[model samples]
Target: MWGRRPARGTIVKICGLRTIDALEASIEAGADLAGFVFFEKSPRHLTLDAARALVARAAGRIGMVALTVDADDERLAAIIAAIQPDFLQFHGHEAPERVREAKARFKLPVIKAIGVGGREDLVAAKAYAEADMILYDAKPSPGAARPGGMGRAFDWGLLNEAPREKPWLLSGGLSPETVAEAVRITGAPGVDVSSGVESAPGQKDPSRIAAFLHAARGAAGGEAR
Candidate 1:
């Protein structure tokens, strides 16, 4: 199922950051990217001004990714105008055509998220190969209040048997303790965390962010050929 090895070090992303301290900690902990949630329903969501400030602090020190769910063109345009994030992450039910359209319209690299609960979910990822990257998150159950950051984990073994040609990230219920295992199991080039690094919903814990990065780096170094 694996196509190519990720770089020697696992690309770490600390997501759902809402504070300057958390943002700085991510960079200090060696995170490759930091994610800002823009979905209002999510407790981690950030306003335009807040997001812009956070992005400014990052200042190209690390990749800044804006997470949205099925946002319309106008909203996306406004966000692009404000923060000009390095990447746009779509976590909604956007189709491949929409992914193509959004990429073309914004002229930004896109990371399409796929919710994986079982084998069927892997099939859904096939349609998004055209995307610059794919994020594999746990599927939300029916009537769930939020789409992701639920701190739930799907079967990592499911990905071990799937076919993948594009770079991808493994997310969902990942914490400092389990990130290494997730990387070892899926061989993901990147791993994303939100709730795992939080002391409470929407509240980031800097210590957890540091530990997660350290553990992920160690695991990536110890992987066998």
Candidate 2:
């Protein structure tokens, strides 16, 4: 997976995909990455068998990401054997040491999702030195059903001066209407969307997916494919 270096454009990841239509739409839209949620509470959560089937369809066409929330090694091992994702996204409260350990044990790249609200959160994300990439998403509301995919957004200005120590993605509350502005404001090299392109929670719309990719690419100064 590391061998397929990102192309010369802003990386776009459409997360929480669950169907052949959504998977095919992502690939057809030239998305750099496709994400699958594995957290049980998430509406977009997928069974190992289902994820494996989607991964088989996506073979070599796009990067597959397995997203989890504080999963233990047994769970992680099971996911690795089944989905064979190119990257593991730790969207929970896994410490830097845990992130490092997972990379060592699994022999795969890791993407650590940091809940961002202010400058301090950005500073703390640097601790994940071993993470191949970092994803900055909005912090969930109190007692929210899930940590992410809530469709809330933080101030894009918060990342205007963020240090470029690691590759990062801007997420949260982005839609086809706003992704261009987000990319312009944050100057993020990558952007990720889940609920933004969905017709509803857990339901992806191909037209919206295409529109988002178009906007994101234009904002990144690349012509839309």
Candidate 3:
């Protein structure tokens, strides 16, 4: 099982990476996790073959996260077989039972994403007792095309009084300019970013990745130069 916090610094995840350059930038920038989207609707979506190539290149270099949206057994198996991801992020409307089932069936740690717009959303997280980690992302607007990675953020203050058990990451609306405040406000053990570091939709920016990592590290009292 994953712990509630990293042993040293605040964990940073760079999500929606689709190219070797983005992957390399995350590695060089000292990001703790590298995420790839599998949802076809997402602009950052990667095909199985593309995922395989990137996974091969990232082998043993950083932690890999396979982000999916309410995937069935076959889709999960195919992705797992191809990328062998270290973590599976359920970024859809999957119930706690599904999360528990997927974790057990796949023998991989699960990061359950909760869309938080208010305190009511935080209450829903309590039901996911079996999740290895929790990601608090901004809730998508009505009729949004995608679930996450939209660069929208909710009120960080909403988490001020929320209690935590397992490891959790603060996502949505995070960027190089705002990560420090997000970290300071939430005291989150980890942070995840996608559109925040992109030059355009689905295009990861190396410089932005580096800057975000530096800011997050500085906020966490780690080596940030």
The weakest ten consecutive residues by lDDT in model 2 span 1-10
Where does candidate 3 stray beyond 4 Å?
1-8
* Model 2 spans > 4 angstroms off: 1-8
Please list all clashing residue pairs in model 1, or write none if there are none.
Answer: none
| 134-190: candidate 2 lDDT, tens digit per residue | 889998776777786388889889987665777888899898999999988988888
RMSD of 1: 3.0
lDDT of each: 0.86, 0.89, 0.91
lDDT per residue, candidate 3, 124-202, as tens digits? 9999998899999999988888896379889999987565878899999999999999999999889999999999999
lDDT of 1 at 29: 84
- lDDT, candidate 3, equals 0.91
Query: Could you estimate the TM-score for every candidate?
Result: 0.94, 0.95, 0.97
Question: In lDDT terms, which candidate is top?
Answer: 3
